[model samples]
Target: MIGFIELIRASGFAADVRQVKLVRHKGDDLDMDQLRNEGWFETYQCFQSKPVFDGCTHIVSVIGEDATASRFVGIYEVQGSTTASPALLPEHCPYTQWGTESRVFYTLKKCPGFEDLEDRVVIDWGKGALAWHQWLTDRTIMEIRPRGRVLAPFRDFLRVHLSFEDLGNLATQPTAHKDWVAALSAVGGIYLIVDSMTGAQYVGSATGSGGIWQRWCDYAKTGHGGNLRLHELCREDIARARHFRFSILETFSRSLARDEAIRIESFFKQKLGTRVFGLNAN
Candidate 1:
């Protein structure tokens, strides 16, 4: 089996394996979702509790779970470090209590030449995931996915479940997965949006011309989907939408009337107590 360090060396990013540390970032599903989807994982990693990467000249970063192969994120050149500030944390950061921990913020520069492998390359880091930070000599190359972890093909609508980040990804890259768009577009549906932060739910339905896809795209873009209560919440802090998770309550054929869709949505709202106990206003 070819080593991960060999591939990195061949790519011409780092000439010496001794100077590099292989780091795998794995956390709870919520943290992992934000890490992968929120676009701040690299910056977030800078706030370590200690100067763990102090002596390393460079670092190879991957994200995955313990006992599982990880996906390549990037290679970063270690520039230097400083004490972390409470204000430096992202607003929606999962690690809100980092202030309690004595953290060192390391300055890292993205190494060039390996941009093509981001999210496409996978590696095996042995079974010691608890030893997340390791010397480059200890890692192994597992697989290289040319498609770069494309979203799985659309399955059943009843089985449809998506995080807020998931919806944003699908909306932002509509052309990336035609089958998913096609599947969502094929039906008008009653859907549920749950604020994972507060357990509040918003029940809604889509019978628009473009079906569920169009309606959800609006929510992905605006975070409120034109609802009064959600608008109020997002107005206070837009990042709060990151706490939302979406799923289908029921699906309707395109032939369903708008009134019938609304009726179905009301049925779910009443059943789920969204109006009285959740985020729904009506």
Candidate 2:
């Protein structure tokens, strides 16, 4: 991603100016209709350049281009504060002159007909030329180079072990899964309850009646558990930990919820080990 600052000069003292950034094509041979069809048409209009009598300043960011990504420009609006009434004196009413400074940035990507360039360039109106130049220079200095640890790449295909326990202390109901499901539904979504002290993790889903805390409490008392890998790991260390932190990483629509849950289980098994439960598919 790139960032830039822009300054615009507007007519009169109207603070309301629309900042439309656009890229102008250098070649006349290019077809405009084809470019428009690709959704690269200019979406904004530039303010009319006129004399200003009041002084006020506003800033904005703009991004757009033609068929070629290289032909893009970002814009900013700079407005001066002044009354449009003719009765005001130039000096006393204070006609303001507003000039804006804009900076632009770009990323690397394929362009069909153009030769690839090592660096993306920016063009802007000359006001704070030095400042804009410095901005670009600083960005170049801070560009990120990807490197370091590369994790096992095929984790998405793995199956995870998950475990569960009914902690309610009451007799296991005829609706074994449904009762706990009701309790968990109140909390909503999937959560990881981690016992930091024991390096243990618990992955579970809930809906409707019980919060995560209540579901865990039920698991603690009953010990009547499910045989998924994650649950067994947590159960092993249940005697050593008294506190755990619950983290909710994602929520899914009902249509995708089951698939998402399975995916989450696999992820934790590969990334977090045995503490997560409910992922066993085989």
Candidate 3:
């Protein structure tokens, strides 16, 4: 069988190939529930260190507790890399909470997968189906397909609740994802950016001409939406600003007066105690 590494190289990528990883993160509970429900495809995956995965092109994710070749998730096509404090790790990848140092970060695009053909066997590590695996040689191959049930189908649709990690894609990808743009654009309203790093919240109003979508687009582009307080926050740490979760606290008609929205914003700030003890400067 053509091994997984060889298959990728034959597909025309020239970057250094790393061994396919069977990421069975023990004790990490954050992303597991979502992965179990959604079939585990996303734009970002993180590592505790870069040196181990440096100069790599891709990581083939597998799901399991032990290194047994039970199942393969899918391939993550590497784009670019950057590092941030463990605090900046997305809610989906909270496994980094165990790390005492900075974590490796990358933007990974999902490649096609044969979920139907993956994980048909459960080979012992370094023998049989998993024999190709070797420490320090991640490009190692594994069984073409284990014989058994493997995956739940990917949802292939947008969900209503927006996640911080998904917001990054909204900034870069087109609006065809549907729910984010449509729901956010449908009304002008009061929204909140909750800082996951420290639980600081910023109350803001989007009662202007373009509504919440336009306002959020400003935030996605500039990481601050031109708010002086948020501008300062971004200046101090852009990653923190990018990790803020955008949620609508309440919605109002697009025709609502802008002044009324500002009042509502202030009301929310006072009601929520954001300005006195949070990120809001005004």
Candidate 4:
């Protein structure tokens, strides 16, 4: 087993090392669904009996045994001893219950493998609520791990296809994978949206401005592209669209005329019987 300080140094927090503190970050269970959507947990505040805080940096470790192997979340640069709620809590954080005092607030920057971390990280106890280990040093730099998402290397971009979840990753943080989005937007193609829940399929074509990326960005944003059928289904419960899986059914030249793209789209719909028994309205 690696010592707390050594493992963190290896994780690339060494440059920003400060004296380790006994203080721990406290918070309620992180929202798993939101983590799935955003790819990382952010700025969790902690309350601890004021430990002797020096200019040392702290490593935030997940206290719950329920937390997965990537138990370490991120590093914290806590300069203050008083832990007050942020000027504004994270939009999703629930209101604090009665009789609680703010301790030390921690910025829980997520580690490299945050997604695979075991599902639960709920708050418990009092100042002892969240368990944390601190490291002390006076390094000037603390680079955030995996600064941004890299495009998946799958041999060919044209052959690229992903589930709704994968697309969500791209949409939620477009800057992280601008290359992937640009490639998709550059080409027009025949695509299919499969409803994983009912095995229904919708055949559609992308053309002109922004190409397939534009079309998919719409789905990522509203879970529907203003399509009469999808709009109705999503309106009923926006989450219903989670059942939607996206993939390329076929490909076409961006230079292909709009008429030809439409013809190909219609052909696939007929071949797949989508209009008759699927999500396609037309």
Candidate 5:
């Protein structure tokens, strides 16, 4: 239960405590899924309908991911701000059109001395939605997960759901998500990979000694997992792999035979029409 300000000071942020504001940003008016999946959160936070940060010299930005927990984004030094206009929005702004004219567009630059702490720190934002912005001096640190937070804890096979980014993170930083990796490695299973961009799906199985964990790690590294269709899809454009979402279709006990796992995988491929209508070619 260390104080968040103490961590900031320890990290070499020499600014006065009074000049810092803790801002927990959530997307209520925007498409949060798209923001998270497509990287629109920063622009969304940069321009807000209200001047919430008017009096702050520096703001510690956090993205609200849970009911009272927020993941640290970064410390931003406020350069200046202006009344939002249609022309003020960047071309990549998620919205098709802007109808609100009362918004404020902030000009912020990433503050130095806090780069190592970004995305690795989480703080307990004291209960309540009304106080999204508060003086930094009033808050305390909650938990600092190494390599940042994983998608979620491993509850059961049915609860397994991961985006491409999540799989990559788990594959690269196994210790941070050891529970999930351990669970995945303990049993072979049938898994599903869907392309969110085209809604194309591929059903596959993992029957090797390393189980589903090893299979997914291959996908994370090569973006194909040695599948013919997946390799072709990624060969032309590797970035297309970012649109993939992974989930478990069925789990099999370690004693299950390799043919049995493949049989279950084939059933799902047929049920989902993945062979003729989706990404699966075999």
Candidate 6:
């Protein structure tokens, strides 16, 4: 006989308690109806045999159907036990009466080549409860181990590697002058540029002082003549369009800020063509 612990809750009778059964086996078609009938009958027989103690009211079973299927097991029935009203031990409160409580009961079942079935049973129960019952299962079990050991570190590593790749690509771009301008703008610094009508090409930098917008306005007011590229492109039969707006894509933390800025400038230069500028350059 398997030594199993059944948890009984406080109710009208012992028959009101829920029964959970775990059957670990493979290739056997367990008839649900038969299990129910047999469980209830067994409870009745126990009640009849023991007049002093009332039988169980509920019975729940978790049976393993096939060994091959990933999840060959299932939880069945939260029924009552057959026992007298006002249980013998009133102080022994059940989980149901505690207003949404959970408990773990261990059963020592006798099965061939499966002495460790309890471990599997606990795992199944824990999973069914959506990991709320993890404490009940063995911590060392392979299936229930912490994800930090297997996946978390790898994910972080991947992210760092991808960021480096982005940085490397940025270093080769000439069109990224605008990105540097935007970065400078964020720090209250300015850049001056004359862009193609399409806003695709730019000549800009962060070395100059004062706000970029104000400086650009000053240049326009002084009649420095803007749109050198746009004018040249239009003369070549390229249709000129509106002035391009500069946008900041991202700001890096202080730790990586300098490197990220260089990367962005390089990436833009590579994408937009090499004719970008800074005050230090002629």
- Leading candidate by lDDT: 1
Greater lDDT among 1 and 3 belongs to 1
Measured with C-alpha atoms, the lDDT of residue 203 in candidate 4 is 84
Alpha-carbon deviation at 153 in model 4, angstroms:
3.5
Q: Give the alpha carbon lDDT tens digit for every residue of 1-282 in model 4.
A: 335455455546544443554333333555333333343334333433343343545544433223222223344555554444545345544434211354454433334533422222222212332334434422222122233442242245445646666777778767767677777877889998887567988888998878888889888888888888888888988788876878887766787899999999999999999999987888
lDDT tens digits, residue span 63-162, model 5? 7765787877788888888887778767866473542577888888887877677767877888765688888765667777776455545678986768
TM-score, predicted candidate 2 vs. hidden true structure: 0.25
Provide the overall lDDT of each model, using Cα atoms, as 2-decimal numbers: 0.80, 0.32, 0.58, 0.57, 0.79, 0.29
Stretches of model 3 off by over 4 angstroms after superposition: 1-164
| TM-scores of the models, in the order given | 0.68, 0.25, 0.50, 0.50, 0.82, 0.20
**Model 5 ranges with Cα > 4 A deviation:** 26-39, 89-102, 129-131, 147-159
Q: For candidate 3, lDDT tens digit of each residue in 1-282?
A: 555545545655344443444343322445442443333334235544554445556655555434443355555666666664656555665344533356666667767544444444222344433332233233344444323333222221232334455565555653334445565677888888887667888889886667777888888778888888778878888676645777778888878987888898899999999889987888
Q: Rank the candidates by lDDT, best first.
A: 1, 5, 3, 4, 2, 6
Off by over 4 Å in 1: 1-3, 36-40, 65-67, 81-96, 138-165, 172-175, 178-190, 195-200, 205-215, 221-244, 248-272
Q: Could you give me the TM-score of model 4 versus the true structure?
A: 0.50
lDDT of 2 by residue, 1-282 (tens): 342222112112223332222223332543332223223322111212232211213232212122222222223333333322333213332122211212111211222221111112333322332221111211111211112111111111121111221122122332324433343344445556555345566556543334443545555553323535444554676543233333554444434455666676557655655433333323
- List per-candidate RMSD values in Å: 4.8, 22.6, 11.9, 11.9, 3.2, 25.6
- Candidate 4: lDDT of 21? 46
Best by TM-score: 5
| TM-score, predicted candidate 6 vs. hidden true structure | 0.20
* lDDT for 137 (candidate 2): 13
Worst 10 residues of 1 by lDDT: 145-154
